[model samples]
Target: MDEMLSVRQLMKTYGKGCPACLDLTGPDHGRNMCPVCGTIVACADVSLDVYPGEVLGIVGESGSGKSTLVKTLYFDEEPTAGEFYLRSYEDGVPNLYDLSSRKKRWVRNHQMGMVYQNPHLGLRLDHSAGGNIAEKLLMAGNYHVGSIRERAVQLLEKTDIPITRMDDLPRYFSGGMQQRVQISKAMANNPPLLLLDEVTTGLDVSVQANVLDLIREIQRELGVSMIVVSHDFSVIRMLTNRTIVMKNGRIVEQGLTDQIMEDPQHAYTQLLINSLL
Candidate 1:
């Protein structure tokens, strides 16, 4: 299958006058008040492709640039080098990182979607489930109130979140249930790709299984390619067929999940696996 998204030679850094930044020739004063010095890349020199209907899992210790990679791929921050691309009807694979602000917003809202670890972060705490879902559809230009209500209900139903809970705020739901609503919202319009940053984090371990199962069900139903970043080996083992292990802002190992789990070549990866054991 053709590449749905591509990232090449990607680099990012925080702080100033750090030795790591010397290689990238970073600014003496870092931009955005980031703590990284010199050019310590949060995520760097990264190249990866997400194919249609595949779920690629990224795993690493905290600050390994797993989520940062997801953010860059989603075009959240300007990369110091390399580029990001998105396929569009008129543009014939336009560069995402280079897009104008207005164009980028349009792409983010209509064509792309994201799911986060915490549902409260992903959802509007003040709004009910109906409102949370509707706001997303509304942002995507879905107007009709009746249509929004109906779609919201349908999505909740599909995600196995009960209809009775529609009017309830996100705070009332359990972590697993909240995650279900979030999945519903992320899959609301059926985007071609999803950027999931630790989708099951913060939830109870028992609940994580259910949420992962829900995500798998929705993926099968929508057939959208996904880039899921997580630290939990169980998440990678249960949800993804392929896994990419990142360490210190670089990809240390990537391949079939089972093989990497059983026979890790990278010492860091082996250490991570052992830690989980």
Candidate 2:
């Protein structure tokens, strides 16, 4: 399969060079902070390729740059230095980072979708569940009221949200249901890329399971490529065919899901697997 997305030498730092910045580029610098200059290195030379219809897992504890990577790809944050490419953009001929603001906005609306860990970031709580999905459709240039509503109903039903409650505001829904609504909205445009960051967090175990199952179903049905970001090994194991273990803004280990789970080469990856067992 062709690579759908490619990111190379990505870096996000809060401050300029300090003498310690160079030294803080190893596994030991998992904190990603420079003790001398107080620079926060959110990502450091990170590179990865995501293929069509593949669920690529990125696992790392908090402050390990997992969120930063997603935010950068979604244009929620900018990378200091990197090359970002998507097969859909100009036939993968141009580096997305070089695109103008207007063009980037077009890519965001038509080609990529992101479901943040916090539902508020992805949803308009005051809007009806159907309305939230309509907003995305509208942004993607769908203006027909009847078609938008029809699409909304289909998505809501797919996510297991009652079509009857389509008019209800997401705020009235439970956290898990709110997440389902968020997913429905994110998929409204049928973007090729989906970015999910700790999506199952802050929910009851059963609700988390349901949410994960819903995500799996959506991916399978839509065949969308996904970048699943989480610290949870189980989440990665269940959803991803291939996985990358990140630490200190760098990938410590990467391989097939089963191989990484069975024989983690990095001490950090081993520790993570052991804790889960």
Candidate 3:
């Protein structure tokens, strides 16, 4: 499979010029934050690739840079330094960071879909469910009301949300339903790249399973490339064929999910598996 997305030498840091911050540099830095300067290294030297139709998992504890990496890719956060390439964009040759802001926005609207951990971040609570999806479709230049409505209904039904409730605000729906609506909205444009960040967090186990199953179904049916970030091993194991384990702003290990599960080489990876056991 061709690489859908490639990231290299990605770094994100906060605070600058302090001696402590300057001193706190290197791949094996002890902490992500500078205790003396209070500078934070959210991510550093991260590199990875996601192939077309592949589900890539990023697993790590809180503050492990998993979320930061995805956020940068999604354009929700900017990286201090990096090279991002999306194959579908400019034939996957140009560095994304070099694109104009307007061009970047175009890429975000037409090529990538992001489902944030919080429904509020991804959905408009006050808008009707259909309206939320329509927003994305409109941003992508689909202006026909009938076509937008049809697309919204198709996505909602596929995500197990009733078409009857398309006019209802997501704020009125249950948490799981709201999440499903968000999923529907994210896929509103059928973007080539889908980003899921701690998507199943704060939901009940059964609800989480339903959402995960729905995600699996969507991925299988649509063949969209996805980057799923989470702290849970079960989520990663269930959804991704390849996994990257991160800790303290660095990638500790990466491999086929089964191999990582059966024979974790990194101490952090082993400790994570043992905790699960």
Reference-based lDDT, each prediction: 0.78, 0.91, 0.91
In candidate 1, where is summed lDDT lowest over 10 consecutive residues? 25-34
Question: What lDDT is obtained when candidate 2 is compared to the true structure?
Answer: 0.91
For TM-score, the strongest prediction is: 2
Query: What is the per-residue lDDT of model 3 for residues 52-85, given as tens digits with 9 covering 90 to 100?
Result: 8999999999988899899889788888989999
- Candidate 1 clashing pairs? 14-36, 15-36, 18-38, 21-38, 21-39
Per-residue CA lDDT of candidate 2, range 1-277, in tens? 1689999899888888677774866577557888888888888889999999999999999988899999999999988889999998887879999999999899999998889899999999999999999999999999999999999999999999998899999998999999999899889999999999999989999999999999898888889999999999999999999999988888889999999999888899999999998
Could you tell me the lDDT of residue 115 within candidate 2?
90
Instruction: Report how far residue 275 has shifted in candidate 3, in Å.
Output: 1.6
Location of the lowest summed lDDT over 10 successive residues in candidate 3:
17-26
* Model 2 regions more than 4 Å off: none
Task: Name the candidate that leads on lDDT.
Answer: 2
Q: Please identify which of the two predictions, 2 or 3, would achieve the higher TM-score against the true structure.
A: 2
TM-score of each: 0.89, 0.97, 0.96
Which has the better TM-score: candidate 1, or candidate 2? 2
TM-score of 1: 0.89
Ranking by TM-score: 2, 3, 1
The true-structure Cα RMSD of candidate 2 reads 1.2
- Deviation of model 2 at 9, angstroms: 0.4
